[model samples]
Target: MDKKIVFITGVSRGIGLEIAKCFSNNGYFVLGTSRSDFDLAKVLSSDECLHIQLNVTDRNQISACLDQLKEIDKVPNVLINNAGITKDQLFLRMKNEDWDDVIETNLTSVFNMSKLFIKSMVKERSGSIINISSVAGLMGNAGQVNYSASKAGLGGFTRALAKEVAARNITVNCIAPGFIETDMTDHFQDKDLENILNQIPANKMGNPQHIADLALFLASSKGNYITGQTISVDGGLFMS
Candidate 1:
């Protein structure tokens, strides 16, 4: 196994799946996860891929996956905290469960996953942790207070973690994507989508591949010097 290993969450579909493919295509071994059952091997031609049925918010399930990695003697060189969900509703109408679920999955899962893997990276003196955030985290969204807070918390988490681990040669960063064409937006009507596209100066929705490409770059040697930064891929939707 000369190829580097990357562990990505939420690989059942959308951006996570695209990142898995991109890494595998670039000669990486992919250890991917999803809340739902997914067969990544069917989509990836690589024999070096493994898929885990995982709920990122669950420590027990995450520990089970940790056991699987140990069985194969694989320590991920990169970790992408990509698993997330959005229960969209007006702040006045939001449920407590919605807020809790979003925070646990979107924010705390970063804590869970990173804590599990960072030990090995620290021992090896090399690693990259990429947190997938959202523009809503930076700019706020009308119907997504929970989701926004979760991702915003991730940015803070990334920066502080980056500083702590930089001495160990591990880098932590966040990617805040604007409206990408994933299932998360599949519910949007044409008119609703038009309103979103209108907001983006580029006047278009980005594909999952766009996000995947950057993930590759960040995990590569080219990104060795970059850390503690939130890079937005939102077609100029939110410039900070």
Candidate 2:
């Protein structure tokens, strides 16, 4: 069998970076994309890893990425729609541009990215797609209306797409992370952090590795049977 290739978006740092490193350490060729350029070798010494500058919200960039992959003869077996952004604002105060930007980056980008790869996947009759969502999408948050709605839409996208490609051996799934200790949360004050921690039953904040490990499982053959479902990894903060 050819060596497996994994394509990850927004992989410069945080959970996406961890997932790339995990896959590389496990013998998968990594093709990671970010809006800004990043040196993949800085974190891992894998010759098989390639980092591409991609703006997921741009259709031209997505097409160019597909063309480049085809030229390189890299058929990605796993596609992780991990690129997303948050525009936090109260509903009444939120700007229209904020909602549009959040929706385009977080949700519409998934549609474009998935469409770019699903054809080759269907031709091969095998693939795995993992979406990185947020717990805000599940239980909702006070000031992240746009962010939450985008993530919530991912659930519907995952289920419908899963059914469409199930017969073709492709699986689509969503992962919602809660209060992970990433740069996204680094801006919180100590008091704010303390308040957030109290809500989590784990008492400690979750790490990027926690999300990465689960993403690995879902992308690998281990999670072949799991599809059209949203799994939360929030230290038991929001239990359904």
Candidate 3:
């Protein structure tokens, strides 16, 4: 049987890396991308697993990458929009560049990638798009107005796109992770980490695999009926 293909962004490390491992383990051909170079030999030696350079924010780069994929006949059955940036600041103190960067990287990139690939998916009548959002998107967080707005916009984008593609048998969903133990959260001061842990019913941060497992399910046939949903894997930090 031909291996299924999954295209994932921001896969140099962290949640994106874990997602690539999950799909690769499940016999999917993972086309993982990152802005920086990475050593894929550490995790996947399979010829099927491809590591590509991509700046999701750049439309030209996205087009070129997709064109290359098409040349290799590696159009993906699944697309994961996992590349995002945080320019966190209080709205009053946030710079215009910070807000613009976050929105473009986190939100607009989703639209650019989705728009490019969705045409093929529509024609094929099968595909899954899983967006990696954040719990901050669901419940607003202080000092992250720009981040929150970007993710919240992603949720709405997921819903609207799901409706548009449902008839074509394409599913669009968002996975909003909360307080996952990644490099992104490693900079949290001890006191800040303690305060965050206190709010979670699980009393701990989530594992990146927690989000990966859910993403795998959503990308697989098991999740055919699920679409237009923001599934939170936050260890009970925000229940919704």
lDDT of 3 by residue, 189-240 (tens): 9999999999999999998999999999998788989999999998888875
Off by over 4 Å in 1: 1-3
Over the full model, what C-alpha lDDT does candidate 1 score relative to the true structure? 0.91
Tens digit per residue, CA lDDT, model 2, 1-240: 244899999999889998899989988999999998799977778789899999999999899999999999886989999999987889999999999999999999999999999999999888999999999999999999999999999999999999999998888999999988888889999999999999999988899899889988987788888889899999999899
Flag regions of model 3 displaced more than 4 Å: 1-3
Model 1 vs. true fold: TM: 0.97
Candidate 2 vs candidate 3: the TM-score winner is 2
lDDT of 1 by residue, 1-240 (tens): 233999999998899999999999998889999877887888897778998888888899888888889899877989999999989899999999999999999999999999999998999888999999998999999899999999999999999999999998888989999999988789999999989999999999899998899988888889989999999999999987
TM-score of 2: 0.97
| Candidate 3 or 1, higher TM-score | 1
Provide the overall lDDT of each model, using Cα atoms, as 2-decimal numbers: 0.91, 0.91, 0.91
Q: List the residue pairs that clash in candidate 1.
A: none
Cα displacement (angstroms), candidate 3, residue 140, comes to 0.9
